[model samples]
Target: MATKTADADLKTASVLAFERKLDPSDALFSAGRWDERDDPARWAPVPVREKSVRGTISNRLKAKDQDPAKLDAQIDKPNLQTVDVAALPADADTLKVAFTLRVLQGAGSPSACNNAAYQAKLRQTVEGYVKAHGFIELARRYAHNLANGRWLWRNRTGAEEVEVRVQHLVQGAPATTWRFDALKLSLRHFDAPGEMTETLDEVAQLIARGLSGESHVLLGVSAFVRVGAGQEVFPSQELILDRDSTKKSKTLYTVADVAGMHSQKLGNALRTIDTWHPEAATLGPIAVEPYGSVTTLGKACRQPKEKQDFYNLLDGWLLKDRVPAPEQQHFVMATLIRGGVFGDGE
Candidate 1:
């Protein structure tokens, strides 16, 4: 006869298997309510990161006055271009999920035991839970979208290449929604060696929490796990440059100059409404007089510190303005080069 503890372990394992196969389409076991299935189009798969660039250099000399021995040396600069990360997009998100398990024991529990049946049961239960809950469909959608979209992978030779894969949700957005900005799933077996029942219980609890519209549970989990792993995850809002500091300047060319220049160039490149804005109308062609002179904007502006200030200013501009779409942000960046914002030897 099986011991009570053994029976409990087997039962827990069975529950875990069931949880694994639970799909979103599955009738809610707790409430016994079945919701209509959602079509794939209801959600958009996250974008993946897969952009790259390549560079090449060449040089030559010119013969002077038809003298073969007398030649003038000319150094050719290297050319840089964005390499197609083979149909990869430029941005994406990532999601992670985790599970943890522990075992329960009574006073009469066996001291020594190995349970293969329990493990198999746990796997089956978890699989069932996941499937019945529509998780498989969700994962499949992400994989399909990512594979059909774009991805960039770096080759062993250091050349960046593009791969087709779905982006993982890394951060942002509340948990519980079908579309997660980011997710983390973890599974751990605790108590007895190789005992996975507790971990599966934890997973079930998380799924239930999610189904209940409890966003904070996942957020707490993310924070706890990240801290335990010694990782730092800051909010996106913090990444934006501070508004006050970004507005001030101590150089001849103000932060406004850099921002204005960036905006102007971006406007031209993206063909942003030819109808001039009051800001652009007032500042006409702040020309690069010498076509490459660092001193065009004066000595104070040429300092490395001031150069950094220009970047900060541009960042501020990007955060505030809606003149150019986010997709065209790179065009604004190009203005830095055109304005000789980095001075010579950049």
Candidate 2:
């Protein structure tokens, strides 16, 4: 069977100006599955194309019912120019891809999304501080994830070689774009190869100061993607990410989802430098917020403890517990005496 040519498989999309980041606020992680995709097969076959990729302007602050991240449900069509890989010069020696991280608007601004109450004064205050401080850190982490090919889940494993250049906007103009091939040095067999790590910290620290309204900073990412036979290029793909995955284990991040692990997983990889997450700056360790332990979401809700020490120990003991609990003692003994484990009360 003829396979899709490497060039035909290369897909790309540039999210129009919006503060984008996949920090903890994204709620992308879970206890059973990993990445933004809850599907068992993380990567799916998407026809590569370029068009005006429009979406709703919202965040996951209210993941559940109140502040659902549904764009069409809340606001009208938000303009997003999505440039497909095919639109770019394909015949060139190497496919040079360029992405811009422009500071579109702040979470405090009323033009951010639909509801003003959602971006109310309190949310604005908290959102501003987060944008100014940890956005760079979050951006660095995102760059690291991208540089290392962490988002290449299944279809596009790793590229033979990749080059990346990062630049920050200054004085209403961008500085010279600096190319870095260091991400190719990323090491971790059985995992995504050619990860850009050693260079990420350096890139993260490049912009030391936090953001301010007056600051018009833009992070530009330009790289070359190869689409040769037996070669793979993992470009960004826009997909539907559902936050509610109660029916399956693949939804939660593989029962071992943690901060670093999820941070590295794919699915809508890194998009923009800033995000609408309320507290994207100071976030705590990986945890189950609405469920896994039961709270306001519902008293019966109990999400698995993927990282908590107590549950980790219990799971370990359960695996080694050859003997069943008292409730199962009668069943065990009856199985030996009778043909099957019938009744314990008898």
Per-residue lDDT value at 237 in model 1: 14
TM-score of 2: 0.35
For candidate 2, lDDT tens digit of each residue in 232-300? Answer: 223333232663533221222212222112332332344312121222244211112211222223432
Instruction: After superposing candidate 1 on the true structure, give the runs of residues whose Cα lies further than 4 Å from its correct spot.
Output: 1-54, 57-76, 80-197, 213-218, 221-346
The lDDT of each candidate is 0.23, 0.34
Model 2: lDDT of residue 190 = 15
TM-score of each: 0.16, 0.35
Which ten contiguous residues of candidate 2 have the minimum total lDDT? 335-344
Candidate 1, lDDT over the whole model: 0.23
Instruction: Give per-residue CA lDDT, model 1, range 198-314, as digits (tens).
Output: 433343344334332342232112101011121111111112256465422111111211100122321222111111111224432222211212233452221234322333333
After TM-score superposition, what is the CA distance of residue 65 in candidate 1 from its true location, in Å?
29
